[model samples]
Target: MSKQRSDEPEIEPFTGPAGGWGSVRSLAEVLPRERVAPDALRQLARQNKPDGFMCVSCAWPKPADHHPAEFCEEGAKATAWELTTLRTTPEFFREHTLTELRGWKDYDLEQHGRLTHPLRYDAESDRYVACSWEEAFDAIGASLRPLDPKSVVFYSSGRASLEASYLYALMARMYGNQNLPDSSNMCHESTSVGLKAAIGVPVGTTQLRDFEECDCILFFGQNVGSNAPRMLHDLRSARKRGVEILTFNPLKERGLERFTDPQNPIEMATGGETQISTQYHQVKAGGDIAAMMGIAKFLIEWDDAALSVGDPPVLDHAFIAQHTKDFESFADAVREANWADIERESGLARTALEETARVYARSEAVLGIYGMGLTQHVKGVENVRMLVNLLLMRGNIGKPGAGPTPVRGHSNVQGQRTVGITEKTELAPVEKLKELYGFDPPTEKGLDTIEACRGVIDGSVRAFVGLGGNFLRAAPDTDAMEAAWPRLDLSVQIATKLNRNHLFPGKVTYLLPCLGRIEEDVQASGPQAVSVEDSTSCIHGSRGKAKPASPHLLSEPRIVAEIAKRIAPANPRVDWDGWIADYAGIRDAIEATYPEMFRDFNARLFTPGGFWKGNKAAERIWQTPSGRAEFLAPGELNATGFADADGRFRLMTLRSNDQFNTTIYGYHDRFRGVKGTRDVLFINQADMAKAGVEEGQIVALESDAGDGTTRRREGLIVTPYDIPRGCLGAYYPEANVLLPVEHHAEQSHVPAAKSVPVRIRP
Candidate 1:
């Protein structure tokens, strides 16, 4: 932390995007801010039993022990957030109305605290009043009954149990609407769609143990330290073992730099940090396909030269011949690829690109890990396939410590999507669910987060219900989402605490408080257990230690079950109560629904560290249409730049150190030296000169998203940094304003946060 400078900003010249550079520097003006602490901080601090409960914050792999340095800053924030002594009770809401609450800032709304009890907004009273759990459930049932099934949307957050998620999907499907939208629809749906299309499975290629035996790791667009910091440990371990972890990103992040693991007694005592990324290439955002193709080209050409001599070949020719198809065409495509195009589009010198290729060729085993940075682009799916193509070129898919690794966010997000929580159009899942639950699930495609927002505004949607996540705030085009949510007949959120989304109440809003993941769930049978799947695709048990924050707070499973039990076929055949009381019955149903994955769910859940599904360790038996890994090469490539007739820059939205997804924990990003605010930009120095802008200057952002929405942020900090030229970046969902819902990847409905053609104006 440092003091703020009132004047005389010494930002290096912006060489990246026009005008946006000046906005990057104003970040210096707001220096060193901290979260104002609540009266009491409820902390587990990674020291309290490692086997207790997984941190709801980030997906950092745990080794089932009480290692002192298990948790990172973000993990701590998540723990504090969940266990915070703060409460958002009915009395507090009684003083506030949806109209008055609409004026509150995102931070203030979350800062007021957790939801203590079930609350129903009273229109006549102009405030929220406390209601009993039964009454709340009844109100939900009443609202659910006669609306066209298509008019209702059932949504879930990633931080939910497997039992809860299954029940939620079952409940919605039983009520005749399979319009299930979830947090994954916003983040990793691209990974699921693209990877499943390419590889048979829809998750990452490498599991936890792969790090120890790997020689190379390809990192694309993932800020490991800030987002999933525990992964830093594996990288650090691999680095010590002489593995080359290549980082390809537009910006140089601090976490990617040498990390001093606080738990390493020697490092902490000696003030030492382990070097994580052996080679860091500043590739332009959305330019990964070109760079990846360059690797395949180098492998083919290098192997040819090697075989021509008396030397061994660079490629595993035997492996390629055994598994892949179209090698000759692939070779010709790479051979004819324009090096100039690759260099310029990638924003990397030819020498640097060749060096990365040389390293990748030398390593026999490699794991390419990516995050939203790759998926939030127009070429997101292509980028995924390109990475797989590079692996297939030399047969890097099935061997030890080699393959694609899509590092996912939201602890159980992968599982949520796996259990039919998708808003996809196919009604087969609905039909299957109907056959199981004795009711026909709606066949029409449901609204995703964006579509739901639009539906509310268009009057197509009568009510919007979110089982857990923050709907209004998580959406792009904040004004539209904020406005549209209130237009609904009934808007409801099942939350643990007060958040900005709760303030955006519709004509009728219900804020039903639920139990946190860390709280013990006592059921009719007795104390129960829940399950969550980590990013590695390993499902494990989670048993909470503390009692519920309040006795009135019900588990999310119970809440969803109650909602289901209330509004189902009048005299439904299935016993929803019997399943809710005993979570295993829910697990048994999950077993029947997904026997290949969840066989004997309860029995295996009690096993040490739980179970690993058919995952990374399962080898390369892809569940794709062809029952094998896939290779795809797009006919053309798109470059990074927001240029008009004249060259400008495209601003890419990013996450700051302070926030997690849409949750505003605080207004400080410790790694980037950003503090006291979430509104700032990062730009290259030379571009500032070209645009005639100075540091600490306020500027308006203009874009061509074609949604007729104007996204302008004044007083933006223009800091000089290592982002690629002709491009700019800022924090999201704040920067999501620049992204129109209409601007998404061609294949996956994911918004292109990686590339938004925009220019900053003075």
Candidate 2:
């Protein structure tokens, strides 16, 4: 059925529990909102040796002395959801046919319970019958025996262990395919692409320690509390010490305005929320690049003019001369930029924009932090370049408490890219993988998410395997993922729980149940531990406390190793079982593979917080092709707000308060007053007025235009918001219905979620 108008899917709102970041029963609804007794949840937590699992939710840096309760609310939710006593055994599948399961919601799919055994969907039987691990692997291996390597696409999630990722990459390379469409392509592809072109590396330039000493912190589109609450403490401490903190975002998230640190006993007792945002600017959705370029624009011209007037100003002329190239063109772009246009288009007044520039100019050190909002646009790469340009103008990189901070969302997402997850560039380490394995890796550039989707539909891709993540739900345009999967010869999902992605089976579907990060991994050796790198490049150890939820549940590493062993090309010397038996062997292999990047891997992992990778920006050393960071000239600006047309307001899909990626928490977003359904769209009052739509009016939104097909979901209740004028916002996956697969960024293939051109149908 080409899904037509929806009279607003009912949204169920949920308020988080009183227990601060760790209290997650309320958020555990990401799986099933059905409330288990407090006693049952308490029991679940008691055994959850959560030490081994990286917080599945956010990338909070690991502590020197790990707390038994180091888990955050989202972490707890994911942990409980994974380690839940529930199970989706063979009988459960037998009772509820695939057809019955297909009718379920995303929450119900995961809530169907964890898979206890390796399952092969039996279409004739209309059930997922349990199969022997050997039988499952053999069947999978035989399926890949004849296809050209390019037909196999190895997709992975950020939550994957370093060992699993390395092995997965090795398998793909050995198989001679580079069709690696990872989570990075979907999220931080812009950051990686932009940062590499502008600076040297694709990772964040600053460390967490820099926050304490930063003179001024500028947050662009990042809501710290909801996304990264640990940053809340840092900003709070900085504010107390008289550091100026400026925030610019489309949504004036209440969490950004004031955050109560439930982590602090005294603050929790007093019920006091820290007041952040010394200055808040509600900039337009696509304004970040303009805003940043405006800042750089103002500082460059102001300082240049000031120097001519015999007055010293803020631009670091000496640093620019020594560490950068192409000054004249950059200066021209900044000087020639029209402030009226920037102010008008960005939805910020000139004075406010100029004042923000002044803050950057005046500060001895500044950190320009951004989230998905900046990098998920058509000009996302340029947007990042402008931020780096501002930093370079003042020599922010390589200085303490300064540089660009791309506030990533997940715990291991950064680690995924660092370990060479991209389909672009043949990274040195990945190259070494080819050299070590004695194979000629595919020289042709690999397909990213969008390319992979298109590849599958066109029959170029024969097999698709996801290490983790909801590929169907996580991807844009539900129809694209659904249509593509059925075309594949085989589709494998190595996941902890059942999701909709698994239901959309290929010709020969295999669902391999894996252990959650929070569960104990008892192999031939003993309990195992994994490591993850946060956005700041700090590597830390994660150990699981909870015992296996099901006796048959396989650890991620074990499952990956088994699959690699079976499905990998013949004549492989590496003993997959040797590594699976003990993660230390995997660590040793990683050390052998990436000695420069991962020195003393095994020894240092025993250290309290693992180790920190040296960030060049911290030392002001740009590793760009020029040996110094190159400041990119600003790109041309795109039109904004649809010429004040009476069309549909622009819709930006957002994650629900309780959701992570495609996993909907309780169908509600509290900060924005959305509850009981995700069918609500946040509309600017002015945009609503122009569109002739009221606050509660329901309307149709078509997510795509270019493609022959369109995703139309109607009956969306419009909620007026304090967002940028002419902008609309709604929850994703549910709203993924409205995001066209083709509406992606230029350099990154990332969906231009923040700025898709759409007209509201009255």
Candidate 3:
């Protein structure tokens, strides 16, 4: 391996708990630097409160017993980032041409702060000029009016509130299309597909309270410290309660290993942090399915041995026989699984697999938690199915402190889907919507994110309307997506801040500035409070307290309503003006759409901690075609096995601790000890030696997408890390270019971001 370079930033390892003084210091440093106003601090403090706005970060559930400071460091950064004094007014846009803005980095683009007014592209001048909301909406309606409704794509970000998402989805349906593609199609789509097949419900069965009672928690493919720091608190508490925490990841994340609670002053002052993972298994990229299958095989063998000897059975036979089907086939598949194949595929020893199974089998309450790592692969759906199989072996569902939970990325991603933002228009919600709204919604399936991009490229999709997100930057194949975006006849972005997507102007492009989550949303009637469902299915109200950055800014609900009125002026099925005036009316329509789950929506929202939209799986009520939980047999352990070629490595894209989704807070990854740069590729020392690369050596990555087209990203510094052999990790959005647009999960169509095959060049 190459020796460390003296000129590079320090790469020392961190061994503290995820939170503590480090988080406090980072928050303090960011607030002042961002020029956060004094009133903004009050706004930040109200985050996650009964009378306040929900954090716009990750979807970790808020605690029922609210803490004075319920937000995490990343949440604080997001709040400060949004509430910054910096503003991108018309003058700012006038100063920066579209060409100049396109050349800026993602962080620099957002750091200029919130957009203050509506802008329309001036092609002659190559700049975005301020335009009135009415003119912008009129342009959108004009472009959309000519195209077939099937050619229009309505995309949403996970940051959208439930009320706004419902109205947006309704607008699309009323216009005679169901091309509702949200961020979930890029992140948790695999989870929804897998879980729905396994347990007849697309949502997680576990609640936040389950963490308190869980005997064992198995985390796969997730780094709670960086992505969802608030989860560290729950994990730490569970650890103290004698709960065994086992983590499976390609790299040994510092937050998962140990974490200091920044909320605990004593821990911060004494430098005392709590140990998190009871055991950390370094599974290779895309090896989670194999690892889970291996664990299942071990559990089956142990159960057989116990039953043959007349000892108490290891499996929950009663629960299995009563609540599930296809078990015998699933069990046989696990039994027939070859140990040698599991070892080679999972990169773990037989002994380690057996030990993990033993721990799982002995535990009465087990909780399985996963993130994008498990869901961003070619076999992502099967990977999650394997996890559910393991959980089913122990009757983990419908029990306190036990179930499978896929920690979502965005705050209201799940909520958006819950409130009818989906491509599948034949779902129950569509039928209910037809009955309630007096409009016959589309029954045909529509384009997801990947399909939408493909449609744009093939000239099938002509108009694109984005409701809050940097779609171009967040998608795979950045160069291809950028090229395809300009092919659209019309493109509109309803956002609070400037992003790379805005720089790529279509034939007719408009930027409609909307109020951020922290800004007060005043409608015709009065101020409104929107609701968002957390990871655990708890629906809570989010009422913004901070003043709007600009008087021109409108609430997301109002923007969607206004667009709907312009696009479908002749439609008399719904009253857009009435709903926009009172958010309660919007909730009433949502209740009519999903009556069972959203009953008493207004009253429950005003409750102390809002309400839980109970999960059918949690209640042991299966809603599948089989009328029971199904144990589907998984395919081969390593379905997407890399070719037996030399110099090949599986690359998984990851987020830096300084970033949230595509928005960058800074260049430093404090948790990983990488300072001042995001261009580093994390690789194991053995892999570095095998590739003939030394530590801190610059390298190029060429995609092995098997499509006969070469895609390469250069200038990535290879840094020796604790990753498994033959595996590498790089920051996302930067490394996204290496992923081909066609590379994605088969069933869900979500991008296979975790298991990209690449060759490193020195």
- TM-scores across all candidates? 0.91, 0.93, 0.98
Give me the displacement of residue 562 in model 3, in angstroms.
Answer: 1.0
Compare the candidates by lDDT and give the number of the best one: 3
Report how far off residue 18 is in candidate 1 (Å): 30
Highest TM-score scorer: 3
Candidate 3 stretches with Cα past 4 Å from truth are: 1-10, 639-644
Residue 243 displacement in candidate 2 (angstroms): 2.0
Question: Which candidate order results from sorting by TM-score in descending order?
Answer: 3, 2, 1
lDDT of 3 by residue, 315-341 (tens): 999999999999999999989999898
Q: Mind giving the per-residue lDDT tens digits that candidate 2 earns over 470-510?
A: 88888877776777777789988898788888888889999
What TM-score should be assigned to candidate 2?
Answer: 0.93
Model 1, 1-762: lDDT tens digits are: 111333533333222211121222322221212231332133354212335677776654556534654555666666666666666777776677867887876767776667788888877877888888888788878888878878998888888888888888777776777678777767776777777777766777667788887899888998886788777777888999899988898888767766776566686656576777788998887788778777677777888888989688887778667665566776778888888887777777777878888998888888989988778776677777777778787778877788788887787887777677877745236555655666666666777766776676678998877888776666666666666777788888898877777776778778888888877788899988787787877777777766577778888888887888777665455777888788888888777777788888878874544477776324766666666565666555562323333445767787876667877777656666666765576877788777766656556576666556776655566666667777787877777666666666667666777888777765
| Model 1: worst 10 consecutive residues (lDDT sum) | 14-23
* Model 1 misplaced regions, further than 4 Å: 1-51, 65-69, 307-311, 425-444, 570-573, 639-647
